[model samples]
Target: MKTLLMGTAVLAVTASTAFAAGHSVVRLGTEGAYPPYNYLDDAGEVAGFERELGDELCARAEMTCEWVTNDWDSIIPNLVSGNYDAIIAGMSITDEREEVVDFTQNYTPPSPSAYVAMSEDADIAGGVIAAQTGTIQAAHVAESGATLLEYPTPDETIAAVMSGEADAVMADKDFLIPLVEENSGMVFVGDDVPLGGGIGMAFRESDPEMREAFDSAIQTMKDDGTLNEMIVKWLGEDSPRF
Candidate 1:
């Protein structure tokens, strides 16, 4: 009976260790409003480049990942609070953000962010440009002579330009390219100043192990053509720095 009890205790310890090792779920967060990065599809499902990329990364890492959506402004704070493990939003690796959270190596390369005007005759060469609120692009627009009108989302920015409420809307090159292609009246006059290198996954400074895992997964995706394929699918062949 003593030997049997000892054997049962050993088995229980082994089972507990296995359970701990198997708990490999990583919670990823994103702003569901950003298209080509992450967005809600017509079917109300989370879909977009970042969503696909996250799914692929989790698969490669042999871990389960759960995606949660939140307002763009709240993403970083939520990450800091441990509400999620990482942010796959198209958030740029800016110096200001670096003060708050650690970022993985950029998966997407640096691309010019620009303003597009809805009016063919709108002279944006020396006019006002608008950008989404609280973004690096907004800072760039403010520097220009154009008065910056900050919106909460890209859709609002686009609407402002479309309705003549704003002279132009500023956003990433890849994001504006598709909008220009689809809308005949809109034109991308010139490239705005480059903001930063590129968008990266962000993690809290406290979670070094999670950050390392995410960085490793992103590098693997980049080396194996996964990242390139995703870029092409979402941003087209002319996408900068594919």
Candidate 2:
């Protein structure tokens, strides 16, 4: 459920040349599909929480920045290959990913992963469960007793359940809450599973300076309570704070 994607566009802001002299433009890559986090608005421009946060962080760091959209599957690889300077997608900071790229301090805390189904009695533990591929939720299902049905996008996983191909779907609780409320038939089932450490921006292993700049900006937001406020504003009142 923690998957989504969309097209690319660039938005740049002029910054203080005194603070950013000689610094290259920092490109922040996102999926531009996941709502309340990163998504493309009607204008085909990247919008939502991460967009605002990324912009603020760049401003604070005195870096001119641009937003880039890429498929979720290639977000990280693109960053490493210089397609982008950092990844601001809703990517969790996991040990496995750390082996490939460095991560800044978490911007959002880990939220519980839950199951949604047509019936509350769906066999979440042993039935077919759909999850977006390459996500922590998919990894969880592979290790759970249930059969894992993988999809490339979150919409497809929801479609799998609607078509009766899967007994249930597991995804971030925050992402599913709005969907379950909108659909009368879908209901939550089984226990809520917490996955990943939290969400963070990623940079290639060689970009320690970029990583540290963003990390410091994130910490400043945390200390001032703005990060927590943004978390609640987009994720809901029950979402965990920094």
Candidate 3:
């Protein structure tokens, strides 16, 4: 997941010293690009499912939180560098990622990836494909017969398809479905590609206590049916339940 320049970038909690000291306020980081997960509204404030869920999680944990937005490419590295206390981005739990950062238990279960193309007949297998860099979809495209075009942001991946740079884009279905429904030119093509584990909050390995706090809060949401209600409210009534 960390594809950027990696040097002596030790996981220091300097950026979140207050949180490390068990302060009441913790800074939460996110990409603010993926829709229905984390994104900035017209007011430039964080708003989405993860935002609502994260706020509730913090409230349940009896802590105050502030939102920090970072690029998808550097989201993890910034977290490892202690740019924030935890990553509330829609990050998947993968072994490769686990090697660099510890993850709270998944809040959302594994979701399927899908290909969005200009037409239903587009060549998804042998044509060029676009995906955000450092993502599971990018790795999948790298291995597939189709040529892979990596973008720093999720919007660029979609733009690549719209501008004829790529035949299709591969990403989480939840992120693509809305775009497909809104655009007459774009439509879901090919079969679904199951990629990555569920979405989870990421924290420094040295901050297990913070991770546990959020983890327990998430479990409480699940036990009390609040999580599913939020999911259905933001995602859809048919969204997966706990």
Candidate 4:
């Protein structure tokens, strides 16, 4: 009877351990350069809409969370290799990406994408716009017959525009509006274009539970005032949301 009781206790302990392992902490990755989405503030702390939303999701799911900053181009590859448990970098959910990793329900709806010229003299609507290679915006630029100066990240493309190296940059309207506002010479030209769909949290294809938790948290935030508050904070009053 004593041996049997010890055996049962061991099995219970093992079960508990397995359960704990199954619900391990989730690590979220982002490119710390895209403002209003994920970026380092003046104090060098990661703070933005995506960062705040990610924290909220982790809290709602009752999961320990850690944020990892990496280059934009490496985010998806790292996620595939298990370097990070998820990606929250304003990543658009498109069919091309679905071929590799699965995405949670879109938290941010699709907003129009646009181009901003750094110089008033620069004809953005007729000239080339710099875009990050392998992004949906790049594909749109390609379709427009405008020369696409491909870069590794949005920061690089923005830098090129600021330096007068590129005539303009094609990106989400929210990102460009703030940038153009801060730079007097910069202005968004041309009508906004629909790139694809909304931005969603991405996770490994096998992690259905984690994906579900994030999706539920995103929906909860959207239903409550949290998402609206964030949009107002980052995008200001006249911001568009679709």
TM-score for all predictions? 0.86, 0.89, 0.92, 0.86
Off-target runs (Cα >4 Å) in candidate 4 are 1-21, 119-126
lDDT of 1 at 165: 84
**For model 4, how does the per-residue alpha-carbon lDDT over 122-204 read when each residue is reduced to its tens digit?**
66655777998878988888877777889998888998888887888899888888778788988877678887778999877
lDDT of 2 by residue, 19-118 (tens): 2345757888999977878889999999988999999899888887899999888787777666778899889889999998899999999888899999
Across 51-104, the per-residue lDDT of candidate 3 in tens digits comes to 999999999999999999999889887887767889988898999999989999
Model 1 gets an lDDT of: 0.79
Model 1 lDDT tens row, 22-126: 657878898888777789999877899898888988887778889888887677876766566788989999999999888999988887787788765665656
Model 3, position 185: C-alpha lDDT score: 92
Task: Report lDDT (CA) for all predictions.
Answer: 0.79, 0.85, 0.87, 0.80
Better of 2 and 4 by lDDT: 2
Tally clashes: model 2: 0
Backbone clash numbers for all candidates listed: 1, 0, 0, 0
Candidate 4 clashes between residue pairs 3 or more apart in a chain or in different chains: none
Clashing pairs in 1: 128-146
Q: Which window of ten consecutive residues has the lowest lDDT sum in model 1? A: 11-20
